[model samples]
Target: AVAFCESVQPLEAVVSLMAQRLALAEDVARYKWNQKVEIEDSAREQMIITKLKAQAVAEGLPEAWSETFFKAQIAASKATQKQLFAEWQQHHAAAFEGVPDLNSQTRPKLYALMSELITALHQAWQPLQQPECQPVVDKLVREKLAKPGYKVAGEPLFAVH
Candidate 1:
């Protein structure tokens, strides 16, 4: 959905996808919690980042830059999940109802969105490297990923070298 969404700028589309990905953390956390799964999955995270870095190379984008951006998204997602877990714990909440399976459903969706995000980011790569893009990217990030735990490092993420 994020990938096909019409936008004036590819960079804006990037932010939208990032926001969409972050938003999915809720369902992910719920499913994980309901299934008694751990919040941190370092192995899977590394695998994903590594895979994306390789893809970034193929796309003519800087690997570290791409990793940084995705890492920020992961961090924000984890933060939101952790916060949700804490709240659920304090409230002694029951398992979430109607959450999608992480493997069969959620992950496939996330991968699709990630693919689109990569394409959008590649399209916006040149402009994103400009110094002037920092403020604009930061502003968009703030507006799109506005939730408290969803906030990322903002302007600092645009420096791709």
Candidate 2:
């Protein structure tokens, strides 16, 4: 994950720089055109500045905030997974209601499968943020895996069914 963050850092930097340059160019063009700086022009320029600054801030945000974003995303994904897992548990239990034992191993495995999906999602989405979320994401992944029955496979944690 750290390696991935490092790799994306340069890409994000380039993207930010390009965006800033574009904003600056637009401003310069407008100024050069000198079409009478009216209220509308001021508003437009303000909008551009806002956008550029947002991009810059996103690119330059502290690593901790990026981590929080990652963790929050992970938490959201996990919550969804947990919900699906519960639904699976109910349906499967009902399906084999009369059965003595309907694959005890599958339940836990399903949970773990969902966890793995979220982990992969985090890895894939982490780069979307200008800053890196690797450190927090990595820690959060481990913390999630530590949960009991998370490693076991059972009903398939995802709703792919």
Candidate 3:
């Protein structure tokens, strides 16, 4: 089952990145709200997806698989942002102070996470095809609940089967 564990390792990285991205979304929502910018940036999202597709091709990963994984991450981030904004609106919250620049600060960090995720995917891609992959991933996620603030959003991409 070493291969199973190896396959699931990348998924753990993906989950870690997802949690971090969700946390970052709070700051992003604050900045957007204060700046009168919309939370949903379709152009930016598409640009990132396009970049991911190209990177996937370069890395020998299936473009469709990588795109689907990245799309899930984007969806989760947007959902968190929307929820935070709605909560702020309900409370009539004041503008956040010392908000960071989205393009310069936030996006760079997200890009780094994306790079790490891609590397992990490249490492785990073949092992993910093993029959034991899904069960091992599920177990790891369950084990992760012992850590505070650890969460699994939806299912791991390789766990679909």
- Scored by lDDT, model 3 comes in at 0.70
For 18-37, candidate 3 gives per-residue lDDT tens digits of 56665676778788989988
- State residue 136's C-alpha deviation in candidate 1, in Å: 2.1
Which predicted model would earn the best TM-score? 1
lDDT of 1 by residue, 23-136 (tens): 888999999999999999999999988988788788877777778877877788888889899999999999988999899988887777777888888887766766666667
Tell me the lDDT of model 1 at 152.
Answer: 66
Summed over model 1, clashes come to 0
Task: State every prediction's TM-score relative to the real structure.
Answer: 0.87, 0.24, 0.80
Question: On a 0 to 100 scale, what is the lDDT of residue 74 in model 1?
Answer: 79
Clash-forming residue pairs, model 3? none
Give the whole-model CA lDDT for all candidates, comma-separated: 0.78, 0.34, 0.70
TM-score of model 3 relative to the true fold?
0.80
Which candidate, 1 or 2, would have the higher TM-score against the true structure?
A: 1
Candidate 2: tens digits of C-alpha lDDT, residues 1-161? 34334444433332232222222222322332233222123454344344433443455543343333323333433333354445545765322222222125422332343334333333344353424544433333344432322222111121111
List the candidate 1 regions with Cα displacement exceeding 4 Å: 1-8, 153-156
| TM-score rank order | 1, 3, 2
